[model samples]
Target: MSIEQRIHAHYAGLSPQERRAADLILDHIDDLALYSSAELAEMSGVSRATLSRLYRHLGFGSFTELRETARTLRQQGVPLGPDGDPELSQHLDQELRNLRKVLDPAGDDRTARAVSDLAGARTVLVVGLRNSHPVALHLKQQLQQAREGVRLAPLPGQTLGEELVDVGPGDVVVLLGFRRRPSGFERLVSFCAQTGARTLLIADGTARRHASSVDLWIECPLGSVGPFDSYAAAMSLVAVLADGVLAAAGEDGRRRVSRTAEVYAELDELDLR
Candidate 1:
């Protein structure tokens, strides 16, 4: 079992002070590997002996063993925080590398095919869950400016079935599936297939297994120097896809954008100041 599992299994038996330390460790689990026993004890307002006892209760023979377990989890791609804060230059270099993969010329053909479907589809549904939601929503907003049929799926307090039930041939479903996707994600893809809707999947490397199942797949590298996955490349890809859709839309897209600007002016909706 992992450190987290061990903590939970023995949590009820821990002394009050040990529980305090355990709680602190759980709260910052991602950074657990980066913290020394002394740092954790000081931050948790617990004695070093309490922290040592907590480690033993959590099934770790020593604080070093606990840290080694956390490091092992990190090596298995658990998104543990880096050993030290990354320098700005290092972060920039990593972002640039990710952007290069996203903007690679080899993927242009696949992108064009996706844009063609988005431009021509009778209905377009953009779906995302968890971290992918913001990217999907942004893409939906951009697509709406280009065409009339764009829609966002599973709106607040909604479920996918309600939006996907009506999808069929001539419709397009764009799925933004980053890492840590829900277990049912593959099932949703299969359902879209059953509806005969064209599917476009934009995801990080973790979703590669599902690539062959979709009509088109765009891989966005999300490597980051910090604990959380970076979405800069994903967002850049959204911009590129939106631009392609606008261009493919021809004069119609231009007219829609113009009309939207007019409405904004008429309602005084935008804060120009």
Candidate 2:
């Protein structure tokens, strides 16, 4: 049986103290990922020994077993992993797998959807701060090339607000913000909620809003490329998304972008030896 169901079946039988422990466990399975039995106990306010006992009563052979069960349950629907930096550079295989799972789920439909959202957008605003900013700017550049009204605001304060104030229904906000909390991403998302703009956030972990709340969410594995979290997987996601949109924007957007490129207006024409 599932951890939840097993716990719930014995719910009426649990003593008040056990119930308290149960409540804590149920609400915070993910936090348990980082906790030892003692740490879990401290957070749950149950004694470490009692916490172990409570999980035992729930049918786990050990605390690790309980944690693993909870982990599996939490990840059932989402495509992701533990919250860590992309710059860590330790887990390329894991990151690649995560990217594939998310992008290939339903055969690149997610990427296609991201593009469709762009093709339909009247204005597109992309936001990210700190280690995440450059990726957001990269996405904005792609959208601009597709002839969308795309703008990326500098981090912090009213500059972001002014950008968001312009978003309305039929607009898309593609936000990239992750662990350690990217400044201003959450507040912008909340503001957009009121404006009725569509929001798509790329963040870390399984939480829909790892750094900030958003409408559509894609979870990218954190990695490291030297000091920066490896955005390899994140970059792959954006590349695929841009390709999908560029392809979906059809003859009109294609013609417009092609004209600009052909005339070398913003497009540069340089000969290389």
Candidate 3:
């Protein structure tokens, strides 16, 4: 595992002081090579002793060792947050690369497989929390129009376990796992697998480490030119996936769309002004 993976894996077990120190390291990863243990400890509001212990807890002998590892990661262009002044042009370049990566042949193949699974499944469950909610909701709406039994994870104050109790063969679960995810993400994936549901993850590269858990993952780069991570790639992926689902659904999709239109017309939901 990489340093980032190690940190993420052990994050939940970290002490309060260790977590604060870890956040500082993750936020300023590019500069980790520059700061001394004392300086880092001061920045994180912890003692130097605590800082030393933090490295050991993360499986390093010393802070210097950890810094050296971080330096190597920086050299490899592992995203280490914003390093300098952000420019619109730089941001646009990164977003363009992200979009291209998603449309590449390998990415297209993965997307096609996900769409095929969804198109043939008896139930499609779209899930996302926090910033991912919009994408999940949008996917559910599109899939509802394309097929039957498509819905977002229900929200009647039910635990995930309760909601998934009936999920078995022929069910598809799509999870949107962007940065700053909820605590129960891995649990959700694991539970779905245990219930015999095929799982697909649309997420940032942060999820690459969890690849073995899901049937397929569409990684949308979240690099940014500003304070916030960009979502242009993710949005593009959503559109492509929806298109793939429609194509795979074929005549069944057309019939579902017609049914949906009939219901909308009967309910007077459309204002054709």
Q: Model-by-model lDDT, in order?
A: 0.88, 0.70, 0.80
Worst 10-residue stretch by lDDT in candidate 2? 74-83
For candidate 3, the TM-score is 0.68
Best by lDDT: 1
lDDT of 2 by residue, 1-273 (tens): 977788899889887878898887677543455567777677778777777678778888898898777556444332233444444344666566766766667664556666778778888888877667878888877777776588887645655666776778988888776665545555666876678888787876743643345567777766432233456788777787777777777887689688767777454574533
Query: What C-alpha lDDT does candidate 3 achieve relative to the native structure?
Result: 0.80
Model 3 per-residue lDDT tens digits across residues 29-50: 7657778888888899998887
TM-score of each: 0.77, 0.59, 0.68
Candidate number of the best TM-score: 1
lDDT of 1 by residue, 1-273 (tens): 987788899999999999999889888888887778899999999999988888777777899999898876664457888556889998999999999998878656887788888999999999999889999999999999988989998899889889998999999999998877888999988888779999999998888989989999999888888876889999998888899989998999999999999999999999999
**For residue 104, what is the lDDT in candidate 1?**
78
For all candidates, what are the clash counts?
Answer: 0, 16, 0
Q: Is candidate 1 or candidate 3 better by TM-score?
A: 1
Which should have the higher lDDT, number 1 or number 3? 1
Name the runs in model 1 displaced over 4 angstroms.
7-79, 106-108
| Clashing residue pairs for model 3 | none
lDDT of 1 at 88: 95
